[model samples]
Target: MEGFPTVELSGRKQHHCAPLCLLHFGPEGKMMPIAIQVQKCKLRCSAELTELLLRRLSQTPGPDCPIFLPSDSEWDWLLAKTWVRYAEFYSHEAIAHLLETHLIAEAFCLAMLRNLPMCHPLYKLLIPHTRYTVQINSIGRAVLLNEGGLSAKGMSLGVEGFAGVMVRALSELTYDSLYLPNDFVDRGVQDLPGYYYRDDSLAVWNALERYVTEMITYYYPCDAAVEGDPELQSWVQEIFKECLLGRESSGFPTCLRTVPELIRYVTIVIYTCSAKHAAVNTGQMEFTAWMPNFPASMRNPPMQAKGLTTLETFMDTLPDVKTTCITLLVLWTLSREPDDRRPLGHFPDIHFVEEAPRRSIEAFRQRLNQISHAIRQRNKCLPIPYYYLDPVLIENSISI
Candidate 1:
């Protein structure tokens, strides 16, 4: 064996370091540790520099032995696949973390109900937390229904906090029911046994509506105020219209039509913002970033400024964030597909059955652009702050 460049390792003991060396052996020969350079508490070795050293190793000539390195495109493809797996894993971890932390969980639920944007300085701090929250909320709604398993005893999150969790969890269930893959529906029901399975999108939509109705009835019993409140009634109707009965459009996914769904999708994001606030107030979380100088256009406006009177204010700003999130994910998945398209079932006025994957992606992007642009225009009229539509946030989110 010849001399190889060494890399320093920190905060690891010799017993733990032995296995790492064993794991990095090249096909040419076993990696032999020639020297151990110790400085202070750090242990350094040359055996672990596999990527740099392996390429320099002499190849053994044989018909069975082949030497090849992945091309840049191949490396990218591998990385993209890894990124998807990481995202999924991160989502699972986030849900588990929330289940363990009652305060964070409560804050998350509260954020969902309030749906208010935090100031830019605080918003940036919460972005990563919100990302994890959104992913977990989207994928872990079913897991939340296991009350016996996830119950946090001796923790006081208040009645409102509990309600927020229940509502957001139900909202996630609604989203999942509407957008689950056909194979997932089939296999999931079969594996569970005796669970009701929806065979088509329409069936799924109906089931979601029923679930939402039942949840509202059970969680928020029919009181005179609730029943008579026009805003609440209209909000419910809008949720149904956008989530279950919205018309198909070229830019937006047929399943995600309105701002309400977007609001639901980003429930975790809202929770993160609220959670950070709670943490900061209670001395649990701190920010190292300097105070942000928000743009003049983004500065708080006078209360007298005209804005959307109804929930349309929420809807208008929401779609911009929602469209951006959906489009980025759609494009990412599409780019990773073997044919640059994934079959997402048929929609009204669209012949998806015979459409090329490339064409479908193009149409989806076009629809996403249109929705984003429309929301931006609508946001201009609103006096309220719009953190979700922040250009920096959008750019950072898409990259993630």
Candidate 2:
């Protein structure tokens, strides 16, 4: 917004936002958004803009912030819903899909390759998750986050604001958030109805935990073995220093102290790379196919005053043709799975050869199949089926 052509629409409303949305479950166990507050960022509220319309120019979003209701005029309701979609697009693509799954998995891939040997047990456990991660992330840096990339030219936030969101989210991120079960429990969404994400993810996490505990116990045997491993210590330290930036407040452990600690950390890495990435990645196209639902950019800023909105003005705020095409093209590229994709729990590679680890892997695969079967049965009765985490559909790593 710093360099936006604010002069072009000086006579009209002078505001920019993507609006925050609050949602709850509907009676039939479906999602229902009740209120959506207009999102405000740093703005240059000029004297030329309306005095009462300063409500739009306000930098702070508060309890009194403007929102839309069902009774709002047709155009106003559309605007509010569009803004809420913008919020989803920004938070979903940038934070959940990109930052959390892709970048974080890249960190684990780098640390393990640098600090651990190919034959090491930890390497055998983690290397499969690193497949195609480097290639995809390299493409992301070159085309997405680079100067004048898709985000800069097409998205409303542009390069600076997108990067700002990334920085702020990273600063606030904690190790607790990465661990599956703890994250749901901490967010108090464990009991939320129609939450297939929580249920499927926790099941995957528990299965991965069982597999990890078995593998680690076979290799290390005791807590003392875990503490005495030099390569393991180095890998953890590298991730703490380089990936987490050594922030003690981040709650990322700098070293492995016990068998349980090692098992939990490794389980987190596996779950994040495989099932978590799939849960967010697979549904991207489904949500973004209709451009208005998750708009790449809104052409006009929001106005506070009622009756100012018209059908023509509403259409004007939508993304132009070029912007929409480029955005949809990029999402399609990122969302689609490749022909050579390996589904979760299906490791065709011969990375782990030892009988004990091989047996654990087989058991893990069986558990994932059971989870998939259960999800299929559950979805038959659900109003909307959730197949995002089905083992047969989920990729083993973030390939796209």
RMSD of each: 27.3, 5.0
lDDT of 2 at 249: 88
Evaluated at residue 163, the lDDT of candidate 1 is 42
**Residue lDDT tens for model 2, 1-400:** 2213222121233334646667777787767777666645435445543342434453444454567675778887777888778767768887888889998899999999999999899998888888999899998889977777765666766666666666656876899889887887897888897688888888888888898899999998999999999999999999988888888989999999999999989988988899899998888888898999998677777656555788888888887777788788888888878899998878888987789989999999999999999999999997779999888898888888
Highest lDDT, which number? 2
Model 1: residues >4 Å from true position, as ranges?
1-355, 387-400
Report the error of model 2 at residue 31, Å.
3.1
How many steric overlaps does candidate 1 have?
2
Best by TM-score: 2
Residue 306, candidate 2: alpha-carbon lDDT = 56
Model 1, 1-400: lDDT tens digits are: 1121111112111110000011223455443332111111112254543443456534232332222112223332222222222222222222322332232434333343333234222132223333333443433343332332121110112122334333333333333432334335554443332122222222323332332333233323445534454434443444344433332321222233333443333333332233222221221111111111100000111111112122433222111332233323322331221222111111122222323433543553344344345446656765652323211122211111
| Model 1 local distance difference test score | 0.28
